[model samples]
Target: MLSMHYIQKGLLFKKPPPPNNQKDFIDNLLENLKQSISLALFHFYPLSGRLVTRKTQDPPTYSVFVDCSNDNPGARFIYATLDATIYDILSPVDHPPVVESLFDLDRAINHDGHTMPLLSIQVTELVDGVFLGCSMNHCIGDGTSFWNFFNVWSEIFQAREKGRDAVVSHQPFHNRWFLEGCGPLINLPFKHHDEFTSRFEAPKLRERFFHFSAESIAKLKAKANEEANTNEISSFQSISAFLWRSVTRARGLAHDQKVSCKLAINNRPRIKPPLPKEYFGNSVDVVSTETTVGELLENDLGWAAWKVHTLVVNHDDTEVREMYEKWLESPIVYQLGRHFDPFSMVMSSSPRFNMYGNEFGMGKAVAVLSGYANKFNGNVTAYEGYEGGGSMVLAVSLLPDVMGALELDEDFMNVISVANFANMP
Candidate 1:
């Protein structure tokens, strides 16, 4: 029964919508959700599902599925014995949820008092209690894509319930078509590089939080850029370089370790006849910045940023493209590979992901996952302006103790303190 519960976190529009027939309202919401998923190559995985539990005095966030086979299908929904009350959560909110503007919703989600596990709903309404929640395969895509799928489904359902034609059509990307267009993955320069491995399970994993102000990062970048005489490097790149160098440094301090940084590269282009912006699905690849810690931190920020940028931008390198094409041509890429230990860490900067328009009635999400965690360990996701202004958040897997040790490093501290914002205490 636990396996049937697919978990996803989203906000409920506390502020009610216009009164309408209950059946029409739900159908409309479902229609919009379906249309969103149809926009991409997302139907392959059954990741979308819905439920409606009887309202309780306490707010709901987790759904428990009951029986699997019977006339009633699953047992009737019951409230979680222990949970937070709606009044307890809403007493601090500055304002009620909003509709129309996505930005307004974004602000609500990011507010200080708002807590994690912000909202949860039962999963038995759409399916029998026996079959609850939707199971989405991670390889199908990322969180942004998932959210888009849900939103469109809601829109389409709403229209249909209103006795209107369903205008949204699903036009997801075809994996085979994408592969044929990109050609085969052949002998690439980095073909020998190993795939990423996981480090620990949930219980064994650790979280380290880092806060930095924007002014400090700007100053550091100004100095580095002037000294290095590089024009294109930006502040975000400079900070990332520092973190990359820091991770490598940590690995070295552990004794001349061979560390590699996986940098995510968006593949909208660099291929002949660039892919259209609207073409969604997973069109991303990770290029490794493999280097011994001894070589990575030997120089200043400029050198580090340049190396990282070079690795990222050169996606079309004959060898690199060859390796990818060859991998896809193999049937294995289509099948899930064996789970292995993740040796390296994934690094991503989301300066704008949270800022995108997500308003849909309820106010914005207080926090969004940085997209770093997986079944593996050593995932790192950083956001410079998560809620705008200058506040920053770093989601990492390092233990708090090691993070404290990093605070003592002069170079690491300076990079975090100056390159972007002041380091959080």
Candidate 2:
């Protein structure tokens, strides 16, 4: 009954290397951004359209579609001036609450898409830099697909500025893939849905930014594999395992208390024959692994990493089809979440995304941040480090006390190059 919000993220950029006296740089950039979005909407038409939800009888189901009629309002572009600096937003001790204002939509959830723009863009000009924030309906696509659209938009912007036809790679694939029993206008039972305009409040928590260098990540993987006595530990699995152990230990929960780690997987490559590389829309599915606090902490990092890896390895094409089949019979839709229990942690998004590659003529983004939308205790956002190697950065949100404990835990800090408060003894 949840997930009625946009997926908003911010890309921080410094003012262009040299201020030009010829023309206003900000004005030119804004114009190019708008033009680029307009061209992007040509392929991603759904972003320019409104959502149409109709009630159906017999099954008490809701049928939703993107209304692409001529009169529909297109994407929104907001230009805001902020009196804050990039360091304030990037503060490691406590993530700045002001980051939420960087987005355009004012508490409008995804279902509000019927009246509001499906894609909201806000360019917050900070005192020292600009924060490019985008709010997109989760129904429009998953994180991967959204970045694909972003990459295309930047490509177009570069081509336009260079006075040439855009050789856009990774063109969007709008071919919707519905379940076997579903039609174009998919219907799902929704006797009573959530309030579309409001957003639920998440528990106030402490968040920290953790950086894992390419070498550190490799060490985590190697350590996990060595301890497990199996050379099959993946990088993601190793890090996830480390977090689970480190956090669980920090929480000091009862020995028998169960803890589950939720993670989202892209279903594009898992399906038989695989969907197109640029397949648009939400094709994400979630898988979770759980264990008691005692068993988790009593074991080595490799044990936990292997546990996470097993679930991922097991969720193969057959498992994927079965999950889809069950959903078709009795659909349980949203693959991402907003509400998480106190003992739960979710590792979200992927470091594999082309975060630094979104070059809009200005140099690549300095760092990335998230809106306060899905901030819950133990909610972690993963992004590739700005300096391009195999490095990764995690924005981890946790209970205040748990974060306090995590700050003191030596194991967690060993593999991470703390961005701000890892030295809190």
Candidate 3:
């Protein structure tokens, strides 16, 4: 409903030629993302609309709009209109575009943790074009959803390029249906909610990037799987076990006591008719596990993997649907994630498949990033394989001490060394 502008003042890495074609790469990218989520697109409309000129009313959604319209197709954009440029990684192609450091949009938004907009974009070439950076509110979806939507949009865009129109109709999660299926749950005077909310204070969140060579990750996973004696384990599952063990150990080390870990439960399929993959919004459930520090540190990783597997498998449709219906009835369950405290920390692991280095005829990108920050003992971890198969990038945030301890553990760092990474590369 509003247009805002930010600037991109970096070298264009071989400036694109004059915009003589109907297909603008930048424009097409924005347009593709727009169509993935119908109403969500309104949150990032191009700069052709008017800038909100009022005193302001609505909580900031931490969303942004970016437009790259320039009058001089070949000229550099104004320095004042862009944010940052891509960071240089030890790879062959350019990484995600990074705006300038001076831009003011990098700060965390004050809105609900889920609704803060995270980026801003600007372009002077099109004169009238602007781009906005907005988010779907963190609680709605994590980077997986963002990347998945981008992947779907890429598919649609490629389809359009081939002169074929791809139409995808997404089915959103219906709270009413969930309610009807499992009766109310939000109002259950379960003492667990009150008890956990008081156990731990809110966590502090920090953002940073980590790189794990593809070689290292593969070898690590293979080694972990071999040690765990499980043929069905994946890199994500193995690494998640590693992190879980490490974090739980750290909590025990700090408090000299036992602790538990919580993993989110996304309940999309639990609903009747299940929501479609393309349903661009929040549709998830959560649950946790209690494990002792001694058990986590001394036991084989297979133990942790089974623990994670058990929680996921046990939370079937009936249990999850009833949980959803209860939440819908009370609307208070929405706040449960924010308030619960039984665990020392909560984590979510996203398996980044082959969607990272998608090429659009420009050499494949060197880096893809997720602006992840861990807050309230809640840390978000994502793993992605890079282009040409080099290292796996891990994006995470947590206390510096915890992060240091994690990397220092021989079991963890040995897998990330350049030599170890090169094995896979």
Candidate 4:
């Protein structure tokens, strides 16, 4: 009953040369990293555990749980070196290399069976910096949990370097029973097993990085609110609406074609008695808005933004709980792999993840990219840019043709900050 998807995140850190008094800086850093990871695992033991299924009923019904016993195999840690520099990746290139090439994917964690480690970290030493890639089983947690582990791990590393004991602000809660008790435990057999078998096929996709400056976001918000005739539209809604329209237009779908925009909404805040901020589990649900291509493109930007806003606003506590109950009735979730025709697009991650703040004593990350994002065409991941101000970096993946069209889109290019890409060395 393990989830078919593995959540993977990557962080790029600038490597500083060791002092004249110290030798082999990279080796010393790696040793300290290993120790820090060991200490961090003490607080996140489930990561070192295995996902095993236990019989829940007489007829072979089963439930999956993390086995963190002493004998359980520990999390996998891999180390490697790359000939290229970090700048080669951070620079704005017309056609960025596939993200997989930037990290050590050979040691990536996969959802194979009960014996597979729940977490795996691969550290690659690049010519100018380091790249850390973490893969966690999605069945155990979501992006929140993933970044929580990373931040804590970084805190431990920084504290260790300064000879101080790290103080954790929040501890993760691992009780899966709380969720099970709220609704029926329905197990839907995997119908698309073939999708899992071929998940790693080299995708015919091109990834691009788009920067939206604070001023541009402000303009988008203002335009959306003014067009919708309501000031209630959020920046996320506004930006998502703009992206939806831009991508739909880039794809050049039929006027009457049905198109959908899906967002991964975190339900923690919307739940009754809201789950603890440190609740380390999957608390996200997908909320989608569907409309005809003609309506979506012809309508005012506010109309699309309002549609996104309302779709999110309507999922109140009651609605979320109801959705949970329904999920329990048929607990099988399917993965929407690559979309070749581009009828829909999914926007995930958030600027709020604060990935740029993950400093491992080397300094803040120059860039952060999700190793597992954009597996499907038309996938968009938004993150706070390294520039600090309220700028945003969108990691977008689309078909080559659609991306070409988007690159030439005047309206879309007008709002994006060319300065960021222009200044790339």
Candidate 1 residues 127-237, lDDT tens each? 101111222323334434444454444455455546675464543443422444653222222221122221223334344445556766676577667656877766666
Query: Whole-model lDDT, candidate 1?
Result: 0.42
Model 2, position 127: C-alpha lDDT score = 70
Q: Tens digits of per-residue lDDT for model 3 on 1-425?
A: 01111111111221234563524756564554344333323232221222111121243222222222333121111123342222222232212223223223333321222122322222212222222222323333444454544454445545565667655333222232334444222233223323222222234534445556666567657766777677666665566676677666544364435666666656655555676654444455558777767777778877777676667777877787676556545544233235545345555545444444333323333333332222344354454554336455554555656765665677665655431112111
Reference-based TM-score of each model: 0.57, 0.93, 0.60, 0.91
Candidate 2 overall Cα lDDT vs. reference? 0.80
Off by over 4 Å in 1: 1-135, 150-176, 179-203, 211-217, 250-255, 317-320, 328-343, 354-356, 370-375, 389-392, 407-425
List ranges where model 3 is wrong by over 4 Å.
1-134, 138-145, 156-177, 181-208, 212-232, 250-256, 269-274, 326-330, 333-345, 352-354, 357-363, 372-378, 388-392, 417-425
Show where candidate 2 strays beyond 4 Å: 17-19, 58-61, 195-198, 333-339, 420-425
Q: In terms of TM-score, which candidate is strongest?
A: 2
What's the lDDT for candidate 3? 0.43
lDDT of each: 0.42, 0.80, 0.43, 0.75
lDDT of 4 by residue, 140-239 (tens): 7787888889888988898888899998776777655345355234344443434233343436888778889888898999999999999999988999
Query: RMSDs, each prediction?
Result: 13.4, 3.2, 10.0, 3.0
Ranking by TM-score: 2, 4, 3, 1
Which regions of candidate 4 fall more than 4 Å away from where they truly are?
A: 1-3, 18-23, 55-57, 92-95, 102-110, 177-202, 338-341, 372-374, 418-425
Superposed by TM-score, candidate 4 places the C-alpha of residue 311 at a distance from the truth, in angstroms, of 0.9
Instruction: Spell out the clash pairs found in candidate 4.
Output: none
Candidate 2 lDDT, tens digit per residue, 249-307?
Answer: 99999999999987888888888878987998988877899999989988889889988
- Position 71, candidate 1: lDDT: 29
